[model samples]
Target chain A: MNLKNIFKKDNIMPVAVLGIICLVVAVLVAGINLITRDVIKAEEDRKISESLSIVMEGGEFEKAELPSDAPSTVTAVYREKNGKGNVVTLTKQGYKAPISITVGIDAEGKITGAVITSQAESHGKTGIDSYVSGFIGSDAAGVESHFSANHVTGATVTSEKIKEAIYDAFVVLGLAAAKDTPDVPEFTPAGEASLTESEAIAIAKELMDGSYTKVALPENMPETTHALYKRQEGGYAIHLATQRIKWSPTENEAIVTVDGLGNITGIKMIQWNVGYDKELLSAAPVCTEEYLNSFIGKNASSLNRVEIVTNATLTNNFFGEALKGALDVLYPVPIYSIIAIVIIALAIAAPVAVVIINKVRRKKNEAK
Target chain B: MKQNNKLSIFLRGLIAENPVLVLVLGTCPTLAQTGSVIAALSMGIAATIVLACSNVVISALRKVIPDTVRIPCYIVVIAGFVTAVQLLMHAYLPDLYAMMGVYLALIVVNCIILGRAEMFARKNNMLDSLLDGLGMGVGFLLALLAMATIREVLGAGTFAGIAIPFLVGEGYSYTIPILTQAPGGFLVFGILIAIVNKIGPKKGEKKRKEFSCEGCPSAHLCGKVSCAENTELVITSEPEVQGTPEGKEGEA
Candidate 1:
């Protein structure tokens, strides 16, 4: 084909248009990129430097190549040029996704500082800042113990992962000792009395006006009931603890003396773990003698009939459940407790059943 | 008359032919970026700049570019503008650039920009295309802001990262987290589209009916009667075949 013919409108015009457009676009993009390239580089470097400064202040650094055996979570490591410490940047699997963290460790293998650089964890209301800060001053020797002790409840997985990564940093630095298979403590069965059998007799003497002897608890003893002691006169003293109160994880312990007929003759609260502020101190029911005395004459079968203390309904309910459970071992008529359990189960199951039924109905309709 | 025409051309993209709500184009970023107001606004501004710049360039090159290679040429132009915006955002607004992530670079494929290039820009002058792009861009920004406001305030109990006191008070937390998820995005997008449809010009309106039929493939069959009754309308710009007999009214 002739050169002029190649330039004809039909043949070359379309190609020319596309080529010219592409050329112009490439030039425009190149120009903008050229202008931004330096700023973008500086910004990225500044961010890393800023993070390093925050992690370990007064430490001059040089990028150190990660070891061949380094964990995949460790992204980059920066060692102090003057032998001050090391700053490690890591991305570890968190509660939701990979959380980026920066850690600084001194020459002594103690964590100088730690910061969560980025995370997608939803438990921002209960932040991991304090939990992460607890890692400071922790060496590999104490890391495992610290990890077990302080955990952010709602953000447990993420917080645990943070500690794990920090510990991994120590391992990367060769500061961690050889891993030992931790000795697992022997498992004690639940409902085993925290109070000794003799201690129960002593507490039982305070509740009832008679000599009492420690007795083996019934086979159906509830998890909350710690020990049982039978009074010589014809009643039993039940020592129990309940940790089922809302907004608190601590236990509430008590001693209840029940007569032979399963009626409570007296009650004493040994421990009240729930805390109330001064403003609500007047309404605090657990401290009042009247509240404990109110349950004195009530039969364990009708424990729910006692007026629940205002603002302490959860405490009252769990305490009642424990007393009822203890009496059931003696009287063995747990009809009201069974009914309550059933009501709770039904409340949870009703919505789930409705959802499943609706799903099935939709499938059937689709099939039709 | 000329001024009114120009104003109408610009104003129509804002609501009457809104690229997101009314026309329903570029939905991916609209849903993905609108979870937070900052991300949404960043995406909106970036997309608008690219749209306006591409529309203007495409309109200027409309005649120079041959019809056979126009789509590829338009894409090149659009991609160029998108890259330029991406570079600027990455350089100056690094945080926003990080937040938007890949969505910032996805502007080249956003249908609103390409759609306007094919439909309005190629046919109109440079100024008019620029206006259309700006108007449509603003419309997209407004729609995203509306959706993000609802999602952030109700779903996250925050407005642009500042806590809404009543929704997230010290002892009280009243947030519906599901509203920030994918399903919520679709729900809000659908409701907003419905509201626009309700308030905007209807398909059966005399103006829309008359204007839509011009590009309708079966216009000759209907003899330009109302398009409201036709369920199988094929929208095209192809010329009517010569010597075809006009069908009777309602035959289509």
Candidate 2:
């Protein structure tokens, strides 16, 4: 290749122009970065410091080394200069986005405060302040119990995430010794046996007309039908189990009381397992006394006439099936009567069954 | 292209050749940011700074840049200015920087900036290019403010975070949430464009059509008089300014 051809004007001009423009841009960008690097760092430091002050007040904080066994959600830990507490910043995955919170844990392993610094929760940041503030003065066990019982009504998932972050903060500070729980606890599926005998009787006494005795569930009853209580005044209280949400292991136990005629007298929610933070459980329009009351005066056949909740359609359908099974157990069709009915049905369908079988057999023969 | 005075060149972009409404450029940021007044204001300012800076630099280096490599060169310069603005905003105005998010960096790809650079900056004098950039920037800001005012007031029942008393009262709060959404952005953009068309000076329409072909980046290649009328062929000419090196196009 000739040197003249290598450095030809056509070949060189475009390259030169592009090269110069790129070089100039790179330099300008570098210069801006150089100028802004310190300002940006200082600004970030100021923000972190402000957030730290919000969580653990009246302390000059300095960044501390995070514990080796700290939960993955724990992002940063800052120690108070006067030994007040440590503020642990963590970001846990919420329903929609990562919920970032700073939790303040004192030397005695009790939470002083927890503030949500940033989150893109489904229900937004409003109304969650009280939920987070409830963590104040709680040790690890208290935190767990409080979290298990209460949450921001519609933002349950976000609230649960914030609770996890706060609890992890306690664990990071070696404050979780109050209760030995795993970083992520195993969610046990709520069993049908969760409803106690006394609790069943208490619910029965509230709904039924008089005293009742625990009785065996009829043989053909649905799996969800736990136990039946026969009323002395001519009715029965049925204990039924349903999942709190279809996707969750946690179950909701409900008590449905029926008169001797199998007409539902009253229904009550017995136990709502809140292990898995299913917002739909709390946000459901049907999970109310009024809704449960609507099921009253309806028998197995009449249950379908009850209006269904918009989101809890599957649960409603399950309730209907459970009630039908309970009623079947109450009104046991005689074995002889069932056998006679089956024979009569078979006698009516015998000709149609033969014709369908013949048609299928003829088609197979034709193909062969 | 005819030369206009500094004032006319600057004033034209405000209403006649308004980048968002009249010319319909930079629709993404206009729609995305105009959902809130603060966001729209921040976006407008950030884009304006980048546009003005890039225009001046591109104009100053126009003669030095080879025609074949101009687009890439323009992008580099524009990106550099955008990054610089981003860094500055991150440092000095962190809140606004966080609010603007990726839209600030996206100014590099905004058609309005590249359009002005190609049409006015590369051809006009440095002063005129600077004025054109400023005028277009201000026009963009004004357009964003107009759209944002409507969106923030009606959609959110607030003006720059302050609640409007009549819109949101004690027992009831009234708001059309869809106005802050994507469809609403298109609706508002179309209405504004239609309004600008209805009230705009007739002379601006003719000037707009003339500049459409003359300022097109691909005008040199196609040698066309108009985009719509393919029958008319025209000769592409070099800048008649002094000291422009001859035969640079041939080399390119």
Cα displacement (angstroms), candidate 1, residue B204, comes to: 8.1
How high is each candidate's interface RMSD, in Å?
6.4, 5.5
Candidate 2 ranges beyond 4 A from true positions:
A1-4, A56-64, A71-75, A79-86, A90-368, B1-4, B169-172, B201-252
What's the TM for chain B in candidate 1? 0.81
List TM-score per model, in order.
0.51, 0.52
DockQ of each: 0.25, 0.26
Task: Report the TM-score of chain B alone for all candidates.
Answer: 0.81, 0.78
Clashing pairs in 2: none
Model 1 gets an lDDT of 0.76
